[model samples]
Target: MGALVTLELPDDSPIHDLPWIITFGPLGDDDEWEPVVCGPYERPHALALAESVVADEDLMAVVEPLLPRLSADEIRGEIAASRIAAEDDAVQTEDADIYGDYEDLLDDEPGPETVQQHAEARPAPSPEELRAGMARIADKLGNLSG
Candidate 1:
Protein backbone atom coordinates (compact mmCIF):
# COMPACT_ATOMS: atom_id res chain seq x y z
CA MET A 1 0.00 0.00 0.00
CA GLY A 2 1.17 3.50 -0.87
CA ALA A 3 1.70 6.00 1.96
CA LEU A 4 0.90 9.73 2.11
CA VAL A 5 2.59 12.34 4.31
CA THR A 6 2.28 16.12 4.62
CA LEU A 7 5.17 18.41 5.46
CA GLU A 8 4.20 20.38 8.56
CA LEU A 9 5.27 23.98 8.98
CA PRO A 10 5.14 26.22 12.03
CA ASP A 11 2.16 28.57 12.36
CA ASP A 12 4.31 31.68 12.06
CA SER A 13 6.35 30.38 9.11
CA PRO A 14 6.12 32.39 5.86
CA ILE A 15 5.66 29.16 3.88
CA HIS A 16 2.18 28.76 5.43
CA ASP A 17 1.16 31.97 3.65
CA LEU A 18 2.02 30.53 0.24
CA PRO A 19 0.03 27.89 -1.70
CA TRP A 20 0.68 24.18 -1.09
CA ILE A 21 1.50 21.49 -3.67
CA ILE A 22 1.14 17.72 -3.89
CA THR A 23 3.96 15.62 -5.36
CA PHE A 24 3.30 11.99 -6.33
CA GLY A 25 6.07 9.51 -6.99
CA PRO A 26 6.38 5.74 -7.38
CA LEU A 27 6.64 3.70 -4.18
CA GLY A 28 9.10 1.18 -5.62
CA ASP A 29 12.33 1.66 -7.58
CA ASP A 30 10.88 2.93 -10.85
CA ASP A 31 13.48 5.21 -12.39
CA GLU A 32 11.51 5.42 -15.64
CA TRP A 33 8.42 6.88 -13.90
CA GLU A 34 8.50 10.63 -13.49
CA PRO A 35 7.00 12.34 -10.40
CA VAL A 36 3.68 14.11 -10.91
CA VAL A 37 3.43 17.46 -9.14
CA CYS A 38 0.05 19.15 -8.84
CA GLY A 39 -0.99 22.49 -7.81
CA PRO A 40 -0.92 25.67 -5.90
CA TYR A 41 -3.89 24.96 -3.64
CA GLU A 42 -4.86 25.50 -0.04
CA ARG A 43 -3.22 23.15 2.49
CA PRO A 44 -6.44 21.24 3.22
CA HIS A 45 -7.30 20.92 -0.49
CA ALA A 46 -3.82 19.72 -1.32
CA LEU A 47 -4.01 17.04 1.39
CA ALA A 48 -7.40 15.83 0.10
CA LEU A 49 -6.17 15.70 -3.51
CA ALA A 50 -3.00 13.84 -2.51
CA GLU A 51 -5.01 11.25 -0.58
CA SER A 52 -7.23 10.54 -3.61
CA VAL A 53 -4.25 10.26 -5.96
CA VAL A 54 -2.39 7.85 -3.64
CA ALA A 55 -5.43 5.52 -3.38
CA ASP A 56 -5.47 4.78 -7.13
CA GLU A 57 -1.76 4.22 -7.92
CA ASP A 58 1.06 2.52 -6.01
CA LEU A 59 2.66 5.92 -5.34
CA MET A 60 3.70 8.00 -2.35
CA ALA A 61 2.37 11.52 -1.94
CA VAL A 62 3.89 14.51 -0.20
CA VAL A 63 2.08 17.79 0.46
CA GLU A 64 4.50 20.69 0.67
CA PRO A 65 4.21 24.46 0.89
CA LEU A 66 6.04 26.57 -1.70
CA LEU A 67 8.81 28.93 -0.65
CA PRO A 68 9.57 32.37 -2.04
CA ARG A 69 12.34 32.66 -4.63
CA LEU A 70 15.53 34.47 -3.68
CA SER A 71 16.54 37.54 -5.69
CA ALA A 72 19.75 37.67 -7.78
CA ASP A 73 21.32 40.24 -5.42
CA GLU A 74 20.56 38.04 -2.39
CA ILE A 75 22.21 35.02 -4.06
CA ARG A 76 25.32 37.04 -4.96
CA GLY A 77 25.60 38.48 -1.44
CA GLU A 78 25.34 35.00 0.13
CA ILE A 79 28.03 33.61 -2.21
CA ALA A 80 30.37 36.55 -1.48
CA ALA A 81 29.88 36.18 2.30
CA SER A 82 30.60 32.42 2.08
CA ARG A 83 33.78 33.05 0.05
CA ILE A 84 35.00 35.68 2.55
CA ALA A 85 34.40 33.32 5.53
CA ALA A 86 36.29 30.49 3.72
CA GLU A 87 39.22 32.81 2.96
CA ASP A 88 39.33 34.01 6.59
CA ASP A 89 39.37 30.37 7.84
CA ALA A 90 42.23 29.50 5.46
CA VAL A 91 44.23 32.53 6.66
CA GLN A 92 43.69 31.56 10.30
CA THR A 93 44.83 27.95 9.59
CA GLU A 94 47.97 29.23 7.82
CA ASP A 95 48.73 31.60 10.73
CA ALA A 96 48.36 28.75 13.29
CA ASP A 97 50.80 26.53 11.28
CA ILE A 98 53.51 29.24 11.19
CA TYR A 99 56.08 29.31 14.06
CA GLY A 100 57.81 32.70 13.96
CA ASP A 101 61.47 33.62 14.47
CA TYR A 102 63.85 31.74 16.84
CA GLU A 103 63.21 34.41 19.50
CA ASP A 104 59.47 33.67 19.36
CA LEU A 105 60.14 29.92 19.91
CA LEU A 106 62.48 30.72 22.84
CA ASP A 107 59.82 32.95 24.45
CA ASP A 108 57.10 30.20 24.10
CA GLU A 109 59.14 27.63 26.07
CA PRO A 110 58.92 29.03 29.64
CA GLY A 111 62.17 28.54 31.63
CA PRO A 112 61.98 27.46 35.30
CA GLU A 113 62.21 31.10 36.49
CA THR A 114 59.45 32.22 34.10
CA VAL A 115 57.16 29.38 35.24
CA GLN A 116 57.77 30.30 38.92
CA GLN A 117 57.04 33.98 38.21
CA HIS A 118 53.76 33.03 36.42
CA ALA A 119 52.67 30.84 39.37
CA GLU A 120 53.36 33.65 41.89
CA ALA A 121 51.63 36.30 39.70
CA ARG A 122 48.27 34.46 39.62
CA PRO A 123 47.56 32.75 42.95
CA ALA A 124 44.38 30.72 43.53
CA PRO A 125 41.50 32.67 45.05
CA SER A 126 40.87 32.35 48.81
CA PRO A 127 37.72 30.61 50.13
CA GLU A 128 36.21 33.98 51.08
CA GLU A 129 36.88 35.36 47.60
CA LEU A 130 35.24 32.32 45.96
CA ARG A 131 32.15 32.67 48.17
CA ALA A 132 31.87 36.38 47.34
CA GLY A 133 32.16 35.68 43.62
CA MET A 134 29.43 33.02 43.79
CA ALA A 135 27.14 35.38 45.75
CA ARG A 136 27.68 38.12 43.13
CA ILE A 137 26.81 35.71 40.33
CA ALA A 138 23.65 34.58 42.16
CA ASP A 139 22.59 38.20 42.67
CA LYS A 140 23.05 38.96 38.95
CA LEU A 141 21.00 35.90 37.97
CA GLY A 142 18.26 36.83 40.46
CA ASN A 143 18.13 40.36 39.08
CA LEU A 144 17.83 39.04 35.52
CA SER A 145 14.97 36.69 36.42
CA GLY A 146 13.12 39.31 38.48
Candidate 2:
Protein backbone atom coordinates (compact mmCIF):
# COMPACT_ATOMS: atom_id res chain seq x y z
CA MET A 1 0.00 0.00 0.00
CA GLY A 2 1.15 3.52 -0.68
CA ALA A 3 2.03 5.49 2.41
CA LEU A 4 -0.46 8.27 3.09
CA VAL A 5 0.94 11.73 3.69
CA THR A 6 -0.63 14.96 4.86
CA LEU A 7 0.64 18.50 4.26
CA GLU A 8 -0.04 20.12 7.60
CA LEU A 9 2.08 22.83 9.21
CA PRO A 10 4.32 21.80 12.09
CA ASP A 11 2.56 22.42 15.37
CA ASP A 12 2.71 26.13 16.23
CA SER A 13 5.03 26.76 13.30
CA PRO A 14 5.62 30.43 12.51
CA ILE A 15 3.55 31.57 9.53
CA HIS A 16 6.03 33.59 7.48
CA ASP A 17 8.71 30.97 6.68
CA LEU A 18 6.19 28.26 5.87
CA PRO A 19 4.83 29.37 2.53
CA TRP A 20 2.41 26.79 1.13
CA ILE A 21 -0.40 26.21 -1.36
CA ILE A 22 -4.12 25.88 -0.67
CA THR A 23 -6.72 23.99 -2.72
CA PHE A 24 -10.28 24.60 -1.72
CA GLY A 25 -13.96 24.48 -2.76
CA PRO A 26 -17.31 25.51 -1.41
CA LEU A 27 -18.71 22.95 1.01
CA GLY A 28 -22.30 23.20 2.17
CA ASP A 29 -22.33 26.99 2.28
CA ASP A 30 -18.71 27.77 3.10
CA ASP A 31 -15.38 27.61 1.31
CA GLU A 32 -12.85 25.09 2.68
CA TRP A 33 -9.56 23.52 1.72
CA GLU A 34 -9.29 19.92 0.63
CA PRO A 35 -5.48 19.60 0.74
CA VAL A 36 -2.89 22.03 2.10
CA VAL A 37 0.67 22.06 0.74
CA CYS A 38 3.51 22.99 3.07
CA GLY A 39 6.93 21.89 4.44
CA PRO A 40 9.98 22.67 2.30
CA TYR A 41 7.47 22.83 -0.50
CA GLU A 42 8.55 23.28 -4.06
CA ARG A 43 6.97 23.45 -7.51
CA PRO A 44 6.68 19.69 -7.69
CA HIS A 45 4.52 19.64 -4.58
CA ALA A 46 2.22 22.23 -6.10
CA LEU A 47 1.95 20.24 -9.32
CA ALA A 48 1.16 17.06 -7.45
CA LEU A 49 -1.42 18.82 -5.35
CA ALA A 50 -3.05 20.25 -8.46
CA GLU A 51 -3.14 16.84 -10.14
CA SER A 52 -4.70 15.17 -7.10
CA VAL A 53 -7.28 17.89 -6.70
CA VAL A 54 -8.37 18.63 -10.32
CA ALA A 55 -10.60 15.57 -10.07
CA ASP A 56 -12.88 17.58 -7.86
CA GLU A 57 -15.25 19.57 -10.04
CA ASP A 58 -15.43 22.66 -7.85
CA LEU A 59 -11.97 23.30 -6.39
CA MET A 60 -8.85 25.31 -7.23
CA ALA A 61 -5.44 25.91 -5.68
CA VAL A 62 -2.89 28.68 -5.38
CA VAL A 63 0.75 28.72 -4.36
CA GLU A 64 2.95 31.81 -4.06
CA PRO A 65 4.59 32.54 -7.41
CA LEU A 66 7.89 31.08 -6.35
CA LEU A 67 9.31 32.28 -9.68
CA PRO A 68 6.55 33.98 -11.69
CA ARG A 69 5.40 30.59 -13.00
CA LEU A 70 1.71 31.07 -13.84
CA SER A 71 0.49 33.63 -16.35
CA ALA A 72 -2.35 36.06 -15.74
CA ASP A 73 -4.66 34.36 -18.27
CA GLU A 74 -4.13 30.98 -16.66
CA ILE A 75 -5.06 32.33 -13.25
CA ARG A 76 -8.17 34.00 -14.68
CA GLY A 77 -9.30 30.74 -16.22
CA GLU A 78 -8.89 28.93 -12.93
CA ILE A 79 -10.96 31.55 -11.16
CA ALA A 80 -13.73 31.22 -13.75
CA ALA A 81 -13.79 27.43 -13.46
CA SER A 82 -13.93 27.50 -9.68
CA ARG A 83 -16.76 30.02 -9.73
CA ILE A 84 -18.79 27.91 -12.12
CA ALA A 85 -18.27 24.84 -9.95
CA ALA A 86 -19.35 26.71 -6.83
CA GLU A 87 -22.55 27.77 -8.57
CA ASP A 88 -23.22 24.20 -9.67
CA ASP A 89 -22.72 22.87 -6.15
CA ALA A 90 -25.14 25.41 -4.77
CA VAL A 91 -27.78 24.32 -7.28
CA GLN A 92 -27.09 20.66 -6.51
CA THR A 93 -27.52 21.22 -2.78
CA GLU A 94 -30.90 22.82 -3.32
CA ASP A 95 -31.91 19.98 -5.62
CA ALA A 96 -30.87 17.36 -3.08
CA ASP A 97 -32.98 18.97 -0.40
CA ILE A 98 -35.94 18.80 -2.74
CA TYR A 99 -35.30 15.32 -4.19
CA GLY A 100 -34.05 13.56 -1.08
CA ASP A 101 -31.78 10.55 -1.70
CA TYR A 102 -32.90 8.97 -4.95
CA GLU A 103 -30.13 6.38 -4.84
CA ASP A 104 -31.43 4.97 -1.59
CA LEU A 105 -34.27 3.38 -3.48
CA LEU A 106 -31.78 1.03 -5.14
CA ASP A 107 -30.64 -0.63 -1.94
CA ASP A 108 -31.31 -4.28 -1.29
CA GLU A 109 -34.81 -5.22 -0.04
CA PRO A 110 -36.20 -1.72 -0.39
CA GLY A 111 -39.79 -1.70 0.78
CA PRO A 112 -42.55 -1.16 -1.77
CA GLU A 113 -43.75 1.84 0.25
CA THR A 114 -40.34 3.46 0.06
CA VAL A 115 -40.15 2.82 -3.66
CA GLN A 116 -43.56 4.29 -4.15
CA GLN A 117 -42.58 7.37 -2.20
CA HIS A 118 -39.56 7.84 -4.40
CA ALA A 119 -41.62 7.35 -7.52
CA GLU A 120 -44.11 9.96 -6.42
CA ALA A 121 -41.48 12.58 -5.60
CA ARG A 122 -40.76 15.13 -8.30
CA PRO A 123 -37.89 13.57 -10.23
CA ALA A 124 -34.42 15.01 -10.56
CA PRO A 125 -33.09 16.08 -13.94
CA SER A 126 -33.04 13.58 -16.77
CA PRO A 127 -29.78 12.28 -18.16
CA GLU A 128 -30.08 14.70 -21.07
CA GLU A 129 -30.33 17.63 -18.70
CA LEU A 130 -27.22 16.39 -16.93
CA ARG A 131 -25.38 16.22 -20.25
CA ALA A 132 -26.46 19.75 -21.09
CA GLY A 133 -25.25 21.02 -17.72
CA MET A 134 -21.88 19.35 -18.33
CA ALA A 135 -21.61 20.98 -21.74
CA ARG A 136 -22.36 24.34 -20.18
CA ILE A 137 -19.67 23.79 -17.59
CA ALA A 138 -17.20 22.79 -20.30
CA ASP A 139 -18.01 25.87 -22.33
CA LYS A 140 -17.52 27.99 -19.24
CA LEU A 141 -14.10 26.46 -18.52
CA GLY A 142 -12.23 27.98 -21.44
CA ASN A 143 -8.65 27.76 -20.12
CA LEU A 144 -8.88 24.12 -19.07
CA SER A 145 -7.40 22.02 -21.83
CA GLY A 146 -8.50 18.39 -21.89
Candidate 3:
Protein backbone atom coordinates (compact mmCIF):
# COMPACT_ATOMS: atom_id res chain seq x y z
CA MET A 1 0.00 0.00 0.00
CA GLY A 2 1.20 3.48 -0.89
CA ALA A 3 0.74 6.65 1.16
CA LEU A 4 -0.56 9.87 -0.40
CA VAL A 5 1.99 12.61 0.35
CA THR A 6 1.36 16.30 -0.25
CA LEU A 7 4.23 18.71 0.42
CA GLU A 8 3.69 22.45 0.71
CA LEU A 9 7.40 23.08 1.23
CA PRO A 10 10.62 21.22 0.35
CA ASP A 11 11.19 17.98 2.28
CA ASP A 12 14.49 19.13 3.80
CA SER A 13 13.32 22.65 4.66
CA PRO A 14 10.10 22.59 6.67
CA ILE A 15 8.83 25.91 8.04
CA HIS A 16 10.84 26.63 11.24
CA ASP A 17 12.09 23.02 11.06
CA LEU A 18 8.68 21.71 12.14
CA PRO A 19 8.08 17.94 12.12
CA TRP A 20 5.89 15.94 9.70
CA ILE A 21 2.69 14.08 10.69
CA ILE A 22 0.73 11.07 9.45
CA THR A 23 -3.05 11.52 9.50
CA PHE A 24 -5.38 8.54 9.14
CA GLY A 25 -9.14 8.79 8.61
CA PRO A 26 -12.19 7.52 6.76
CA LEU A 27 -12.11 7.72 2.95
CA GLY A 28 -15.75 8.83 3.01
CA ASP A 29 -17.58 12.17 3.19
CA ASP A 30 -17.97 12.05 6.97
CA ASP A 31 -17.54 15.67 8.00
CA GLU A 32 -18.22 15.04 11.68
CA TRP A 33 -15.54 12.38 12.11
CA GLU A 34 -12.12 13.61 13.24
CA PRO A 35 -8.93 12.11 11.79
CA VAL A 36 -6.25 10.50 13.99
CA VAL A 37 -2.94 12.36 13.66
CA CYS A 38 0.36 10.74 14.69
CA GLY A 39 3.74 12.27 14.49
CA PRO A 40 6.32 14.80 15.12
CA TYR A 41 8.28 12.28 13.05
CA GLU A 42 10.97 13.05 10.48
CA ARG A 43 9.68 13.44 6.92
CA PRO A 44 11.14 10.18 5.54
CA HIS A 45 10.27 8.13 8.64
CA ALA A 46 6.70 9.40 8.70
CA LEU A 47 6.12 8.39 5.06
CA ALA A 48 7.52 4.87 5.53
CA LEU A 49 5.58 4.31 8.77
CA ALA A 50 2.37 5.59 7.21
CA GLU A 51 2.71 3.19 4.24
CA SER A 52 3.30 0.15 6.49
CA VAL A 53 0.45 1.02 8.89
CA VAL A 54 -2.17 1.50 6.16
CA ALA A 55 -1.11 -1.56 4.13
CA ASP A 56 -3.68 -3.86 5.80
CA GLU A 57 -6.29 -1.32 6.85
CA ASP A 58 -9.14 0.30 4.88
CA LEU A 59 -7.94 3.82 5.84
CA MET A 60 -6.01 6.47 3.94
CA ALA A 61 -2.82 8.00 5.34
CA VAL A 62 -1.65 11.49 4.45
CA VAL A 63 1.91 12.64 5.21
CA GLU A 64 2.26 16.40 5.47
CA PRO A 65 4.09 19.10 7.41
CA LEU A 66 2.71 20.02 10.83
CA LEU A 67 2.60 23.79 10.61
CA PRO A 68 1.38 26.28 13.21
CA ARG A 69 -2.33 26.94 13.14
CA LEU A 70 -3.54 30.04 11.37
CA SER A 71 -5.47 32.81 13.14
CA ALA A 72 -9.03 33.74 12.13
CA ASP A 73 -7.92 37.16 10.83
CA GLU A 74 -5.29 35.56 8.60
CA ILE A 75 -7.85 33.16 7.14
CA ARG A 76 -10.25 36.03 6.44
CA GLY A 77 -7.56 38.03 4.69
CA GLU A 78 -6.69 35.06 2.47
CA ILE A 79 -10.33 34.68 1.47
CA ALA A 80 -10.64 38.40 0.62
CA ALA A 81 -7.54 38.26 -1.57
CA SER A 82 -8.89 35.24 -3.40
CA ARG A 83 -12.21 37.02 -4.06
CA ILE A 84 -10.43 40.14 -5.41
CA ALA A 85 -8.32 38.03 -7.79
CA ALA A 86 -11.42 36.27 -9.10
CA GLU A 87 -13.28 39.55 -9.65
CA ASP A 88 -10.32 41.01 -11.54
CA ASP A 89 -10.21 37.94 -13.80
CA ALA A 90 -13.96 38.26 -14.52
CA VAL A 91 -13.62 41.97 -15.39
CA GLN A 92 -10.68 41.35 -17.74
CA THR A 93 -12.53 38.53 -19.50
CA GLU A 94 -15.61 40.73 -20.00
CA ASP A 95 -13.58 43.70 -21.33
CA ALA A 96 -11.47 41.68 -23.77
CA ASP A 97 -13.04 40.60 -27.09
CA ILE A 98 -11.71 37.00 -27.23
CA TYR A 99 -13.92 35.87 -30.15
CA GLY A 100 -13.54 38.91 -32.45
CA ASP A 101 -10.90 37.34 -34.75
CA TYR A 102 -12.59 33.95 -34.66
CA GLU A 103 -15.88 35.51 -35.76
CA ASP A 104 -14.15 37.06 -38.82
CA LEU A 105 -12.64 33.67 -39.78
CA LEU A 106 -16.08 32.06 -39.51
CA ASP A 107 -17.52 34.68 -41.91
CA ASP A 108 -14.69 34.00 -44.44
CA GLU A 109 -15.62 30.29 -44.70
CA PRO A 110 -17.48 29.25 -47.94
CA GLY A 111 -20.37 27.77 -45.90
CA PRO A 112 -22.51 24.87 -47.34
CA GLU A 113 -22.78 26.38 -50.86
CA THR A 114 -19.76 24.42 -52.18
CA VAL A 115 -21.05 21.14 -50.72
CA GLN A 116 -24.50 21.64 -52.31
CA GLN A 117 -22.86 22.37 -55.71
CA HIS A 118 -20.69 19.21 -55.56
CA ALA A 119 -23.69 17.06 -54.65
CA GLU A 120 -25.79 18.66 -57.46
CA ALA A 121 -23.08 17.68 -60.02
CA ARG A 122 -24.00 13.98 -59.60
CA PRO A 123 -27.53 13.14 -60.77
CA ALA A 124 -29.63 10.30 -59.28
CA PRO A 125 -29.92 7.03 -61.29
CA SER A 126 -33.21 6.41 -63.18
CA PRO A 127 -35.60 3.66 -61.95
CA GLU A 128 -34.83 1.47 -65.02
CA GLU A 129 -31.04 1.85 -64.51
CA LEU A 130 -31.37 0.90 -60.82
CA ARG A 131 -33.45 -2.21 -61.70
CA ALA A 132 -30.83 -3.31 -64.26
CA GLY A 133 -28.02 -2.92 -61.71
CA MET A 134 -29.93 -5.01 -59.17
CA ALA A 135 -30.55 -7.69 -61.73
CA ARG A 136 -26.83 -7.89 -62.56
CA ILE A 137 -26.01 -8.34 -58.83
CA ALA A 138 -28.65 -11.10 -58.46
CA ASP A 139 -27.26 -12.99 -61.45
CA LYS A 140 -23.68 -12.81 -60.06
CA LEU A 141 -24.86 -14.08 -56.64
CA GLY A 142 -26.79 -17.00 -58.25
CA ASN A 143 -23.71 -18.06 -60.27
CA LEU A 144 -21.55 -18.00 -57.08
CA SER A 145 -24.06 -20.24 -55.20
CA GLY A 146 -24.09 -22.80 -58.04
Which candidate achieves the best TM-score against the true structure? 1
| Candidate of highest lDDT | 1
Off by over 4 Å in 1: 11-14, 73-146
Candidate 3 minimal-lDDT segment of 10 residues: 114-123
Two-way TM-score contest, 1 vs 3, winner: 1
Backbone clash tally for model 1?
Answer: 0
Better of 1 and 2 by lDDT: 1
Clashes (N, CA, C under 3 Å) per candidate: 0, 0, 0
Q: Note the Cα lDDT for every prediction shown.
A: 0.74, 0.52, 0.68
Q: Assess every candidate by TM-score.
A: 0.45, 0.27, 0.40
Q: Estimate candidate 1's alpha-carbon lDDT, on a 0 to 1 scale.
A: 0.74
lDDT (10s digit) by residue, model 3, range 59-95: 6888877644244455568789999999999889778
Query: Which tens-of-lDDT digit does each residue in 1-146 have in candidate 2?
Result: 11122345555645434334543443333554455444334445655765566555455445443222134455568889999999999999987797676686665875446433345644456657766865675476544545
